[model samples]
Target: MPTLTKPKEHNRERPVVFMENVSKIYPNGKTAVQNVSLEIEEGEFISFVGPSGCGKSTIFNMISGIIEHSVGKLEILGTTPTLARQQSTDVSFVFQEPTLLPWRSVLDNVMLPLEFRNVTKQEKLEKAHHVLKMVGLSEYTKALPRELSGGMKMRVSIARALVSKPKLLLMDEPFGALDEITRQNLQSELLRIWETEKMTVLFITHNVFEAVYLSTKIAVMTPSPGKVESVVEVPLPFPRNEDFRTSHQFSDIAAKVSQDLKF
Candidate 1:
């Protein structure tokens, strides 16, 4: 996509997600990612912003160990997707869609992931209530998915992701499908959760404003056959509110991100 740089030498402590000179070429010889390197530390919110087909999802998959890299090193939990999953409950992904089962109640849907772990049913129930409350859905615990709005359903999805108390949370455009009002509302809600949970987050978004509002750092990628173009820092203080979004500083940082998305 653009002239790529050499991968950086990383510290041995191994930041939560570490990639060095990584590339992924499919069987048909199509290269989706090229020489990408990044380091994410604990308790940081990192967002990936890029245009369509620019390998944002590819880099995301590599971090989650969903797919392997053809070259260079990726140090997550393990090499294989299955191993990556089996090795940890410390990581969780919240996809764009809520993906709730129709029959389950809101509380039940949130509790489902915990069922797979070694905890007792009582513990699972407790965790479900805790996260549902965290997402401001405590009163809707008994409501069915059909009874909820798009925003509420997504809140359940987020609560489900947090039920495991993960150390790293990877969110893939989790608010992209919502209306403007709902999207902004959820953005505020997410920041609150991040403040309380204090976990590392890796988010993928096409919206520069969203990236600037939620992230500590934004990793901008180039066009197809993606490479890290730049990592823009958001020096804004956290616990941000509506006023922060409307402030000139937020507008300035958002402009920088928009510029990075350019060819």
Candidate 2:
């Protein structure tokens, strides 16, 4: 059995997520990632972009402790990834799809994470309601997932992730399935939530424009048996909008990321 060996107290000197020449190799002798190093600060919104099978999802799984690396150091929130993923610690994940329970009402699905928590029923309800409102889903709390549109369903998923008030949020292409209009709308909504919550976000996206728009920093990776090609900085100020997206700086940054992305 592999047990977690983490620092007794949170190590404030380190970044929120620190990866030192990490690599992931599967039992089948597949090297999904190699020599990937990154340091995410306390409140940054980072987007990772690469082609399919480029190990973007692999990196995410490692950070969330769903899988372990074959070599090198990776820490989340000042501790080992596995330990940081425990309850009472601040980490949450939103998948590429809205994996909600179709049978449950929106509010019930959002409140499920709190079921095992030590909080009282009232506390859970308050937290659920607060997050639902934050995602603009308060009015549809009683509706089932089947009754919601794609965008609304995703909103509920985000609200559910936020219910726990995670300090680090990992989203794997959460808006990838939506139409362009809805995707852009949710992008703005996400920025609003991030600005207020101040959570460190790690996002995965295939779209370069979306990556540049949402990220304070963007990491580009190479194809299969992935390795980070480069880290591109988005120096633009936050509260990004249509104007920022249209600006030359935005295009310049997006082009830089695009150039770094290898086929």
lDDT per residue as tens, model 1, 1-263: 22112245775454677678999999999999999877677788989999889998888787777888899877764344446667778788899899999999999999998787789988998999999999999999999999999999999999999999998898999999999999999999999899988998989999999999999989999998999998889888888988988999999999988887888
Candidate 1 backbone overlaps, count: 0
Candidate 2 residue 207 Cα shift, in angstroms, is 0.4
Candidate 1, residue 220: lDDT = 92
Clashing pairs in 1: none
Off by over 4 Å in 2: 1-12
lDDT tens digits, residues 1-263, model 2? 11111344765466888888899999999999998888788888989999999999999999999999889999998888898887454999999999999999999999999997888999999999999999998899899999999999999999999999999999999999999999999999999999999999999999999999998888888997888887788888978889988999998998888888755
Top candidate on TM-score is 2
Whose lDDT is greatest here? 2
lDDT of 1: 0.86
